[model samples]
Target: MLSSFFTISLKPVTRPIFLYLLLLAVCTGGTTGELKAADNKALAADRKKVDSLNQLAFDQKRFDVAQALNNLFNAENLAIAGNYQKGLATTLFYEAGIYHQNGYDKKALATYYKSKLIFESLKDTLNMAIVNKEIATSLYASGQSGEAIQLYDESLTVFTKLKDQRQIANINNSLGLVQLDQRKYDIAEASFNKALALSIEIRHQYGEKKAYYNLGLLEEKRNNFARSEEYYLKSLAIDRLMNDKFGAALNHLQLASIHQQQGRSDASITDAKEAYSSAYVVSAYNLMKNASARVIDVYRQKNDILRASEWQDSLVNVLNMQIANEKEYALNFIEVIKNQNAKNTNAEKDLEKQKQVQKEQLLIITVGTFILIIVAVLAVLALVNYQRQRFFGKELKQKNEIIEKNSASLDQLNKEISHQNLLLEEDNKTKNKLLSIISHDLRTPLVNTKGVLNLVNQGMVPPEEADRLLQLLETQYLGTTSLLDNLLFWIKGQMDGKEDDKVKVGLHQLIKVLEEEHRMPLMKKKITLRNLVDRDLAIVTEKEMMRIVCRNLISNAVKFTNENGTIDITSRLGDDHCLYLAVKDNGIGMTKEAIEKVNAKQYYNTTGTSYEKGSGFGLMLCRDLISKAGGELIVESEPGKGSTFTIRMPLS
Candidate 1:
């Protein structure tokens, strides 16, 4: 019957025919039932044909062969009747490759491992190598770079022994990328250069381009800007020639960074926009988003407010487009899987009850037709969706590009405005200083002149009176000149941005000098002046600035105090390397609001009890000078109560 069947079916039966015939005899008691025998023979023959087709399809990268082989393996009675373990393993490996090609990495990984174990048991070295490479690739795709590197290394060793230079270069490129992630830049650069050299030697342009791209990234990390730029341009030229959109986009991004560092804002904006556009074409979301953001930053830094705002809006649109594309991809992939599974399940049930003879012959043809139809429909739908997404993404990207261009102009405007504001502030400070000098320095001499003139008008004395008046006039002129000199010195120091002359001065000595200067004025008001400054206390400050601060505080106290009122001057060492100097007076004090205003460093002025007029600049100058000497000026006053002014300075 086997011989007749081979003749009728026009198929050559190979090894295991006798064993299959013996099994048939045992099951049918040596029956010459040609139908059952032919059915068994036909089932084995179909399996062999499926295995042959599967091998051819895998070699040709045709996934439909896998579907046909899978259908044959699912034949329940036939699978059980014959030992199909070898055939099953082969089908599983091919199926895994198909899934991997389709980007179903996790599923491909699971299938690859299952086939790997089976092949290991069967001692299939060639299939094992193939499976390992696929598994490593899946690992890399899933972000397990460490594990992927190890696997790729192992596979590379095997392929190297097999004299597969193409696969070796491929593995080398992948390993270099892993090294880059580990921040082993030098090693990565060496690896990529070696790979590139090998690829050129072998005339593999694709591998050469990939190696150059990686080398460009390594040089960028090393801050070898000129070398990096050269490599990136080379990569870009190659990628463009090869029509590699993703690589081109990445190259543009690197070029943009170079422009940014060189302060070529317009060129940077142009490169960034091109990068974003190219990245969008390839769906490189991270690169696109980053380039968009860089354009925004450049515009903002240049003070181009309009351009900055425009790019910001463009960034939002790019983000939205990326999200929409991801959603569409996920949805399309899920829908394809669902329809395939439903068709597979229904086909399995239909084949289960078929008589073995008919089932074996019909199953392959039936399942192949069904799968082909489904795949065709899915491919069409996916193509349509891809077109839609790409169209919208391009539109959104163009809008963003326009925004980036406008932002560049706005940034320039902002820089101009900031420069103008700085100039305005400097001018205001100069005007304030001039007004202070005129109001405070000139008033003293004018008052003294008025007093002397009143005495002269009375004509109370003779030639001696005229001499006394001249002396008074000379004293007032000297006072006014001293005030003017101090004012001019402060103004020049401020204009030149000169820091104060810090030195260590004894607190006791400083207080005594100030007291001696104010003794006559204090005596005129009949105010008692007490000094409790520690002789041993010392402070680091600008000596002359400190003298001005102390002189102003004591002079104001003397002027404000009532007749017979007491004024106390004291210093104490405080914790944390500080010295506190206090000048307290029993005089007409200030209201709470007035004290607050004074403490807040706001302008506050009032005529003294002795009618001593002030510029209101005295305390402000004191505050400013004290702050420059690393000290603080604080005022404590209450309505109708005494006021205390304290100076806190860092101790030597």
Candidate 2:
């Protein structure tokens, strides 16, 4: 009589408590041979029947499997006396599957995770892998391809270890589908090929059909029409052999699509019709509608208005049928939902009762625990503050001592820095005085020597001896002049505190005058002068200072150029209306070392090409004058190549 009661209670409940009662009853059953056999067979068959019903419910889009499984799970709990581990795991799996089919992926994922934890606790690796694969499928369907691939890989590893080739092939096929979604064509193709080979080896017809279908889709994506057609046909053959009418219809539809892309309109029409016929046989409303639409397009393109219109009407009818089917599915879904809601309502009430009981117990415990914790916290706080105050006092004393020592040291350092600054100022004043004296005294001798040489060259002395004397005097005069000019300008720049007097001057005219003045000297060296200047170019600068800069640059160019060497002077208007002047000379250029020294902020001297001595003050004067004029002096030179000096000044 207890066995009878247990069997009756195992009829599936809508509440959770019955789950525990069922397990207790099953364990308490002291049954011998017949009762045990009957119970085992009934349990196995019961699960199988539920699974079959669930699949049907899903296919028909009922979406009530959650409520159904909850009821079954409750009954199983009662039957197993709350130890319905296997039944609960299976129910959760089916419930998640239902949510997945109904497009409630988030709910499905949560349920799958719940089921996963239970399976893991039970150490059921096989069902765990299956649940993982289903979860991956759900993820892939929801456009989470990357995550799906990782899950599929993990599932495949387990299946491979179990030596379950058929299951591995299924995982491979799923992985291929995800790869296809990700546009990873090569990997997709390899995965499909692996699945196909394994399926063929095991003669797993469903796996082979799926693999071929995936390969066809991949080929179609790649625009390999011929290969796509071949795979579609292979998949169609397998579907036909297995009597899978839906698969057959899908295959024909895909082939028609390929045919249309290949411009085979008649073949496309024929294939599309075949797809419609197959779809009709299977009552696949969506596929029939798609095939009819394709036929209408094909006929319209072929200029068969009558046939196109007929197919168009057929497409409309199929669309209406599809809508009706969807509405019917929606109605059934609503009914199933109403049933689920009724079950959930009852469950909620029971859960509320349990929660109220738990809340009352928890509140009492929490109040007592809170009182104890507050007292402990107050005790800890007083001890922590006392220790912190002791540590802070020690820190304060150390900081005070360090502050006093630093203050004394800083005062002494300040006094030493002040003394050093005074010495540096005095040294700078002495250097300035010396530079001024050297500049003035040197200029006096150079001017006197130049005047004497000029008289000798003008026949105030014997002509034969005059040439040698004049050359020697000219060399010495140039050296002294350059030294005095650079020294005076550098010293003045260091000491002068007045604004430079600026005026607008035609740059081209100034350059022309310099070129003419240097022409005689340049000709003596056999240097050819090429002037490329815009006559309209003008700049604002100090006239006297600019003249000195121009004279120095031209003189240096003339001195450096070898016999028959070319010297080009170019002037142009630059960006921001700046006048840029460049003097280029093909000469015995200075080495990198000499160029570096010449550019330094120190006195650097060198000899001219005519064995003439130079104080290197020419470039220094040029640099200072250009700076005072708000211009830049740039030089480019190499050891063997020529040099170019560019002066950039703002145009007026």
Best by lDDT: 2
lDDT of each: 0.76, 0.78
Worst 10 residues of 1 by lDDT: 72-81
lDDT tens digits by residue: candidate 1, 8-93: 44332322444554575476554547667886888789677657756665664532433433443343223333446667677677
Q: Per-residue lDDT of 386-431 in model 2, one digit per residue for the tens?
A: 8888899999999999999999999999999999999899669657
The local distance difference test score of model 1 is 0.76
What would the TM-scores of all predictions be?
0.41, 0.45
Model 1 clash count equals 8
Runs in model 1 deviating more than 4 A are 1-108, 118-127, 137-146, 283-286, 347-652
Which residue pairs show backbone clashes in model 1? 302-411, 303-411, 304-410, 304-411, 305-410, 307-406, 307-407, 308-407
